[model samples]
Target: MRAFTALINPIAGGGRATRHWAPVAARLATAGADVRVELTRSGEHARQEAQAAAGAGRVVIAVGGDGLVRDVAGGVVPGGGLMGIVPAGRGNDLALALRLPADPDSLAELLLGAEPRTIDAIEADRGTPGSQGTAAGGVIVPGNVYAGIDSVASEIINASRWLPALVAYRLAPVRAIAGWHPPVFTLTLDGVTSTLRAHTVVVGNSGRYGHGLHIVPPALVDDGLLHVMTVGAGPRRAVISFLRQAGHGGHVHRPEVEIRTAREVTIAADRPLPVGADGDGLGRLPITVRIRPGALRLIAPPPEAHAT
Candidate 1:
């Protein structure tokens, strides 16, 4: 443990990061961390800053939300640096899933006593299969899931009165009829093939989903496996049923829904599709995701997290 730096994303949580800084910084400092704050200017800026300081022997505290935490924790992964997260965003999906306290006081105590442990992560490759950023990158693209992509389930949980996220999902059209239809793709897990014209496909290194939806409840961040979840195809009735199941966090049991706990996953699509990485969308599809177990040293939550 060295100095404490808070990489705050002001836009997160309707400006939670901006408003709560005074109290959070005061608490962390009072807790004996030589606290400093850094506000993000744009996408990936937080990541760049955290990555640059990965090896500097400091515990970078990513404040904002899950997206911000992912961006910051991302930097320390490749080089094995210690990282912690403060839940200031709307979802705080990771914190919720990990059972960390949502309040600042509990989080500060957790950060101070948290032991460093390796967490699981994924490597996604596209096009002709070159390399995904880090964590794991030794495999090649597997199937026809790359080109055309769509995300089946999202816990985006953003507040939109016009079309609230959960409602929109609860009532998704058979196919995206706005003329934005996702191509049918192929996913292969352990040499088993499944065909699907789906709502979306999410590749996970960590088990957290949009908001707090644990799409893959059995997924462990240190398990060295990619938990792949895809919503099934069909008409609105079926999609609605699938939506119902997704809400339960056990959508995998649905015949239409496909879940795979695998070390390597190959996805192929008709067109180059976009993939969401920890809520931040990135790259075209035809990405190969593989797991790197215990690759990054994450500051643990309190022991209650283990109880959870």
Candidate 2:
């Protein structure tokens, strides 16, 4: 029997995963899947467990939100293993991007079918020492890599992970907006340099994030390109208003926001700015993001069911 290992984040979706995993696991077993479920004790533990499972040639599944997916992908990507996601997290942007079913049973059905396809992954690395830059760790973002105000906002949202999703989603941004400051950013896209005073720079591998904001509406998972968006430095009121408009992708059409595509991007700031991927803060800039096309195999939606 083919082995399948699920790394479930117990606290994901405000403890929804903890409640759901037993039934999900039972359903998968009832369907004759050779499945074993493990609850992640922490972020690092999830990565270590996922790495070990994938290295053993088992299909490693992430059973939580985007952060859990991020941890699992970090382990699975290095081994070229097959991955599946059960969208039990607060912001399941990767799940939305891949057009996976939200329910656990349907997810189990999809996993058992074992239809895998190649998808692009974004690899980010920071500049080395002797530099004014502060951090050295890197991240592999499955959905998006964003810096500046968005990162600050994500940090707030993550810090409130214990709150109910709807309340936290509405409250966190307001809190973050009060403390946000626009930073002068220098960005390079595919070797071309430009300078801007911006509140955020979002590099998207898949556009959907923040519980359904089509931040980069044109992003495609299998495409060999990254969508880079710059949200210009604007007044607090304006930034908050833009975020409101962003719910329906209206922000992309705003004068302060510019959208473009690139194979690689470099973002640096006058100060160390916060950066995040899929609503989890990775580290700070100066950060370089590059696309590795078809880097991993994922269980994706059927062609007709996929989001455009």
Candidate 3:
């Protein structure tokens, strides 16, 4: 039997994670798997517990939202350990991107029977001293890293956690856009540099964010490349239209939207701007994001199911 360690954030999704974990744990125990449960106090604590468990040859399972998954992956990836997930938070975007089974029985079967698939991840270097949930000067992102207005919107969504997920995710962007102005952005991709006035820039490995927005429609976790989406500057009405169309990726066809692939990308702004990864804030602008190929070994659905 495989030894498994589940790092859970009790407060994630307003305690939804703890409620969701019960059936999953029961299923795992019924299968005779050696399962250890650890309730994480904070993102940094989750990282430490995951690292220790991974080092002990245990499969580390993140039992919370996208933020927890990112934190736990920071620990599991460095040691070449396998990881799994139970989507129990407000925005399980990473789990959604990977098509993870939500049913406890199916999830348990997949966890016990599936072979780990190697996938890419994004590494964001804040170029400053380490902060909470970050190591050294960088952090591992399991989904996407973004800046500009989107980051501000992330702040709003995180703060409004008491509201329903749909209500918070929908209203936060509107509030963020109300007082926002486009900023000049400097983007260096691979080696070429370009300057633009844009509303947001998203570097994605899994393409999904903002609770299912297809921000980077062509992003793939195993593609070994980062998909960059630049939402060029536009009027408030146009920006609203673009976001409405973004639900089904119709915004990608708009003139202001640009998507490209790169192995590395450096994002900087004229002034200080917030940077966010997965669903949490990283720091400020002037961040370097690079693709880490095969950095994560995840127990997910087959490759065909992951195709867009």
lDDT by residue (10-106, candidate 2, tens digit) is: 8889888866667667777888778888889977777778778888889898988998898888778776688888888887888887888767778
TM per candidate comes to 0.80, 0.92, 0.96
lDDT of 3: 0.89
Model 3 over residues 1-308: C-alpha lDDT tens digits?
Answer: 77899999998888988788888889989999999999999888888888888889999999999999999999887756889999998999999889899999899998888988999988888776665334565688989999998899999999998999988988988899897899999999999999999999999999999888888888989989999999899887687777788889899999888999999999999989999999999878889988889988889988765444
Candidate 1's TM-score: 0.80
Q: What would the per-residue lDDT of candidate 1 be over residues 188-307, giving only the tens digit for each residue?
A: 776788778875676665556555556666666665677777765555455445545655676777776666677777777776666656655555566666766666676765323433
* Arranged by TM-score, best first: 3, 2, 1
Model 1 stretches with alpha carbons more than 4 Å out = 127-182, 190-194, 302-308
Model 3: lDDT of residue 28: 88
The local distance difference test score of each candidate is 0.61, 0.81, 0.89
Predictions: Cα RMSD each: 4.8, 3.4, 1.7
Please state the error at residue 4 of candidate 2 in Å.
0.8
lDDT of residue 62 for candidate 3:
97
Which of candidates 2 and 3 reaches a greater lDDT?
3
Stretches of model 2 off by over 4 angstroms after superposition: 128-138, 303-308
Supply the global lDDT for candidate 1: 0.61
